[model samples]
Target: MRMDEQFILRVPPSVAERINRLLSENASSSEDKSLDLEFSEDGRTGTFVIGNDRFPASVLDLPCVVESYKTYDDSALVKTADVGQMILVRESGEASPDVVEYRHGLTPPLRDARKRRFRREPDLNPELVQRDAGDENARNANKKAPPAAAAKPEVPDTGGNAGEPDGSDSDDSDDSM
Candidate 1:
């Protein structure tokens, strides 16, 4: 719950270290602990204890978290900024008493996005959902399968020149001999 404690953001160890370094470098003389990380879910936020106490907490506004995020991005954890991967930045609630106090022992679902597949239910109308059966056949039919290429005649090897015209019967052969 302090500015110095902001370095405790749950991140990869390597990233965390880098973040800590950055935070220390950017540290101000006076510490501020007004910001915190708060997590929440409509009906699915709970804690599991191995052998420690759990308590609700708020989100932290920390430089380490931001720096850690940068490190992860630089490391290409999600792949890329566009196309192959994406990073989802979201705010659960405004900073204040209205913030959801998630349990400490609980593993909050960070960057929880809906499943990509089946994002929207199929249309109710059968006709609208109907797929063209003959479409594939028609497409195949329309595409004229290219004609098989004519086989090239193999040139006879006379030992003179493979592609040169055969003039064995000419005076040239007699001259060579």
Candidate 2:
């Protein structure tokens, strides 16, 4: 449904009966017998108020109410005269109850992108990106050095005097001891 369009919400029979009962009960005591339907910020939940008493209400199959209250700048007001049986919600003036079925969730409403606020593009630094790339290149070069060192031929060790740092005669060293 359009943001500015008027829609009708068919009140359940149980709720309508209770409202009528409340209206009749408060007719003698209370001066204001008007039905007030106030929706939560999310529009999924609502309350029906008459005089001093309040009744909790759940909004069923009305995604447009949820979308309008959450996204658009338009505000919804229910006519007190239309409070009996069904509710007529309009931006400004009165509307017929015949337009109720079209506003249901059968056909998804088109959202106006122009009315919605989108996130701005993020700011990036060219210097930081270049520095990160350079650091990665250095790390890759260091990683290559270890493999190259491992590829070198290991020298085979010779037993006895060949393994020793200094060459000496064994019999001569024993005589000195």
Candidate 3:
């Protein structure tokens, strides 16, 4: 890799995801969208319509995978940054808006962040754990029958009869009275 040779930062898988997230957060503003983004070869050039702005394919960055025609590498499909959409950049000075390579790759800052995220998972925060446990308890509470309520047996009334009534006992026996 030389200063003049085409070189990009090699990134880990976890770092790549974080970079994408940060980029989304950065681009969330309306003002950010108004700022022109310029990139090259993203399938978006001539492929998308954005209001009155008709951006050509030259303005998008394409996401790329390093697919070597030579099938002899350890990881045959080299992981590479493929620009996806043309980014419209704000004009510098009086110059025209230029397209540049902006990629969704892992940079140092995001790499560290991703590492921290994965590494810190085992150091559980008691508060967060409690909150999650509380939520789970609430969700399951409806399914559990409480012991106090369950202990009371339902007594079925057989109209005061002791399972059977002797037929010799007549109801009209009170007629003599």
Each candidate's lDDT (Cα)?
0.37, 0.51, 0.43
Q: How many clashes in each structure?
A: 6, 0, 27
Per-residue lDDT tens digits for candidate 3, residues 1-177, read 633213233233443444456457665542223323344464433222222343333342333323223245656754344333333322122233254544332344433343454344488899999999999998998686666645667788767667775556667755666
Which run of 10 residues does model 3 get worst, by summed lDDT? Answer: 46-55
Candidate 1 lDDT by residue in tens digits, 80-128: 2221111112223322334332222212342222232225555576654
How far in Å is the alpha carbon of 139 misplaced in model 1? 1.0
TM-scores of the models, in the order given: 0.23, 0.25, 0.16
Candidate with the greatest TM-score versus the true structure: 2
Model 1 lDDT vs. the true structure?
0.37
Q: By TM-score, is 1 or 2 better?
A: 2
Stretches of candidate 3 off by over 4 Å are: 1-65, 71-126, 142-177
Ranking by lDDT: 2, 3, 1
